[model samples]
Target: MPLYWHLLKAVPSLQIIAHRIVWSALLVAGWLLWKYGRGWLRQTLAIPRAGWMLALSGTLIAFNWGLYIWAVNAGHVVETSLGYFINPLLNVVLGVAVLHERLNRVQWTAVAIASGGVLWLTANYGSFPWIALALAASFGSYGLIRKLVAVPPVRGLGVESLYLVLPALALLLWGESHGDGGFVAHGAVPAWGWGAAALLVFGGVLTALPLIGFADAVRRIPFSLVGLLQYIAPTLQLLCGVLVLGEAFDRDRAIGFAFIWVALAIYAVDGLLRNRAAPALPG
Candidate 1:
């Protein structure tokens, strides 16, 4: 994200998003084609429900990507980290509300604590943390939609990319014509030069690789483990925002974050205990 914020020095967030979509679409499409041949596309297109779900998820994730890019560049990295910190708890809420799932008392308590933290942030942290809420909402909704849809991660991402690619390409072309594009132009190189262009292009790999790896990891490991591991991202993001990027983390915000952190600790411990108590199936 910090790298993205740095890139924003040369490229606008919209263009970065467009490049991310276009190049990711091409890469994912190529990989799908190579591995599954043309039949995969046919098989995927046959699933109308999945397609619609992916479309909605794609839009939500696109909004998330754009918002995150803008927020980081706008010096709201700490708040962005807060969004991701809030995401897992929001997922718990969504599971109950949207999926009609049950939560244990401990889980409920965690949710309550996180909610209190958010409210405290809003009440005392100067302004309503809309950026954090929006990020959490957009990403939480995206995750929920993806979970409900029966699609493999890579293929799902491929379809989502396809849904956005046309407009992304159009946007890039428009930018290039207007001499505002960051990657390349008709005859002139981008003023930011080749390094930024390389990063812009590499953004596709950066976007797809982690998601693919994460999906594979989920398949191979216990989901509870994945849940526990999810904290690493926001933790590092918070560190980056505070230590690396030099963002403000005053006492009021620290208190608010402390509430959320305590909530997460409770949630994680409960999950671990529950997972351990459950009977293991024959391998």
Candidate 2:
């Protein structure tokens, strides 16, 4: 978030997103080529319904990335943190609704508590918490879609990057033509300097690695369990917003967040107890 805020000081969010997509496509392409040879693309393409599903997931993740970058740069890091905090519960809901995953009573209770927290925040928030809701919904849906699709992590991300790369390239080209590009300048003078340009390139690796890891994890674990673990990210994001970035965290917001945290704790404790009680598998 800090890196995005710094980069967006000199570059438009859309342009930054374009750079992310284009560079990520290059990185993923190279990885796919090296790891699976040239056959990976053909093999992925042969999967039933993979293309369209990945297309939808790609679009969703692009929107989520763009919104997060713009929100961070717009001095709404706290709200963005709230968005990610809410995402895990949303994932739990999605797991039950879309995947037909059954949740124990305690897990359901956690979801109810989280839902109440969101409602409380919305009702008293002075305005709709659209940023939080949108982020949670898009990302939760993205994870669900990725989980449903049969493609492997690297290849799924590769396909997603491929789907978005053309438009990203076009956006970059347009920005350059309009003298608003961040990576390169219209004249001799560079736009935003080479440092910013380098960061934009590095953004691809930052973007791709976590997503690949997430895709791999989502495939290996139950969707709701993945959601439970995701709190680690939002916890860090919240600290970054409140401590490092110095965003406001008043009483009302704190109360709402407290409710969500309590819910997460309940869900986590229930899972741990269930695991402890279950019989050990034969070694």
Candidate 3:
């Protein structure tokens, strides 16, 4: 992220993400080809079962990436933090709504308390926090879709990357037509420089690595424990937004965040007591 906006002065958010998908898809595809050869796509696709669901998951995850990059660069890092903060809670809602899953009283209480905080924040802000809501909803939906698919993490990502190839290519072409593409080999943008361009290419590897790790983590740990730990990312983002990015987070906003935090505490405790497992993300 620092490389894109701060150091390399990259192009628009869509372009940046498009480049990421291009490289990531290529990387994952190459690995799949070399490892699985003829059976690679066959094994990963698993149509009549997980195909449409994986495609939907792919779209949602890409949407999450593009929006997140936009939010960070648009100087809404704190709100981005807030979006991630509520992602797990949104997962709870999605599970119930989409998956027909049920919740216990503790979970219900947590949901109500979080809704109160979200409502309070929305009212206080006098407008819906679209960035936060978009982030949480997109990611939560992606997770839900991944839960329905039974592909391996790496292979699934490869297929998702496959699904995105056309759209990503189109975005890049559009950027080039407008003379706004920054990933060009002979451009003035810092990312166009050989060194920065190489790093930019490496972004694909960087992106997939975390998803791979997360896939492994969910497989090993209790879902509730995973829920307990998911806060680390958003918490750090919050601190970075407030301290590093210098976002305008005042007492009014803090009040809403406080409620959300309390709700998370209740949810986390409930998860610990229940020890339910969560589905792994396919990335």
Q: Which candidate number has the best lDDT?
A: 2
Kindly list the per-residue Cα lDDT of model 3 for residues 188-253, writing each as its tens digit: 364355665676588788778777676556545444344446667887888877887788988878
lDDT of each: 0.79, 0.86, 0.75
Better of 2 and 3 by TM-score: 2
RMSD (CA, angstroms), candidate 1 = 2.7
Candidate 3 overall lDDT versus native: 0.75
List ranges where model 1 is wrong by over 4 Å. 186-191, 213-229
Candidate maximizing TM-score = 2
**lDDT (tens digit, per residue) of candidate 2 on 1-283:** 5545555565888888898899999999998999989999889979999989999999999999999888887777777777888888888878888889999899999989988987888787777888888998899899999999999999999999999999999999988888788878622226547777788899999899999999999999999998889888887787888897788888888898889899999998999999999999998
Measured with C-alpha atoms, the lDDT of residue 88 in candidate 1 is 72
Model 2 collision count: 0
- Cand. 1 TM to true fold: 0.90
Candidate 3 TM-score over all chains jointly: 0.84
Model 2, runs deviating above 4 Å: 2-4, 186-192
What is candidate 1's lDDT per residue for 81-154, written digit by digit as tens?
88887777777666677667677798788878878987888788688789989998888777777666667888
How many pairs of residues in model 1 come into backbone collision?
0
| lDDT of candidate 1 at residue 5, scale 0 to 100 | 57
- List TM-scores for all candidates, in order: 0.90, 0.95, 0.84
